[model samples]
Target: MASHVGERMSGSIGVNILLYSFYALSYAIPGGIILIHSLGGGLLDMMFSMPMSRMQESEADYIGLMLMAEACYDPREAVGFWQRMEAAARRQGEEVPELMSTHPSNQHRIEKIQSWLPHALEKFQTSDCQGTSAFADAFRRALERGTQFQTIYM
Candidate 1:
């Protein structure tokens, strides 16, 4: 479990870095275009960019969920993760309208995940691995423990 989790976490870190880099580059391209052309870039530019940013975020979520599913982690957990993130954001007083935010709203994320879950579950089910490894079992136990802890404390 430790090894699997470690590998997944490491891979996730790399993937996230790559995704964010792409997102930054995407923004930079438009900003550069606006600056070079003197397109009167301002709130309007930002407003136009918002949809692209949200799309990037949504793409990242979809890819991440698929990666997790491929790694044998239940993709359903993604919904809980987003819910917790939303709760945390609320606690931090960072609530923002979905249209203005770079990322989709948590409700939207959860709904998106739910929409994709059947495909994720099919991937999990069709995987050749016949049985759970001890590592997977331990990982699941740890995840459950973490969920319980969050429920009790958060």
Candidate 2:
């Protein structure tokens, strides 16, 4: 049992590393282009780079969602997470037009996540892992607490 758990942990770690590496590469490519075009800094460079940065951010979110679903997490929780993010952004007055920002607008992210959810649910259903693990349950509870806190404060 211990060995099985260890193997699962190792696999999860490997998956996390791969996902993070992919995210870094995705960020670096657009960042490099921006750097080259800007030759340090400029408004035009920022204008060109914003779209690419937003695209990369959306891509990362998609990939991360898929990874979590593949790992047997409840992908529906992602919707709540994004809702919290949107709320936080609104509270901080950081909400911006989608095209002008480096990240997708919260609404865009929520829509994207919703659209991808059916596929994620299929993956989760087919996975051998049964129900949420203790850790995931704990995490979900924590997230719920956070959401509740946000609702109360913001």
Candidate 3:
């Protein structure tokens, strides 16, 4: 019985890694070299593709927030996480730089996350499975939105 549980757990870990790997690759293809090879960014993708990806990130964050609520996470966490991320970036202050910062200003994202909190909290109070599964679903949906062909590139 214990071995069976271990086997199931190992299988689940494999699935999660596979899911994330595919998502990263899907985003990377149109994203160009910077998305894949950390050291080989195409000039055009660097100049243009990166910023477009940032906007998509912001859009995805809000979309993710909604889906998290729908799947019953405490979406309120988005507010705090964004705020902390912003403060960290400000501290970084161009020392290292980013490839594609798809996040909006932390303050803006905090406000957006705040707007979703009440509903998310309500869902959190009602749901089962601790909400991680819902987050995984939201991730899959966002990855589904990425493509080899495209729309609002930025």
lDDT of each prediction vs. the true structure?
0.72, 0.74, 0.62
- List the lowest-lDDT window of 10 residues for candidate 3: 94-103
Clashes of 2: 0
Tens digit of per-residue lDDT, candidate 2, span 1-154: 1243454455456555654555555566857554544443244324545555676677778888888888988899999999999999999998888766778899999999999999888887787665457667888899999999999999
Best by lDDT: 2
User: What is the RMSD, in Å, between candidate 3 and the native fold over all Cα?
Assistant: 20.9
Clash count (model 1, backbone only):
1
The candidate that achieves the highest TM-score relative to the unseen native structure: 1
lDDT tens digits, residues 34-71, model 3? 54345333543455545555556556776777677667
Arrange candidates, best TM-score first.
1, 2, 3
Deviation (Å) of 2 in candidate 3: 40
Instruction: Quote each prediction's TM-score.
Output: 0.60, 0.57, 0.40
> Given candidate 2, what's the lDDT at residue 104?
88
2 or 3, greater by lDDT? 2
Candidate 2 at 104: error in angstroms? 0.6
Q: How are the candidates ranked when ordered by lDDT, highest leading?
A: 2, 1, 3
Error of 1 at 47 (Å): 3.2
Model 1 lDDT tens row, 1-154: 1243454455456545654555555566756544534532334334554565676677778888887787777888899999999999899999898886767899899999999999888887666544555677888999999999999999
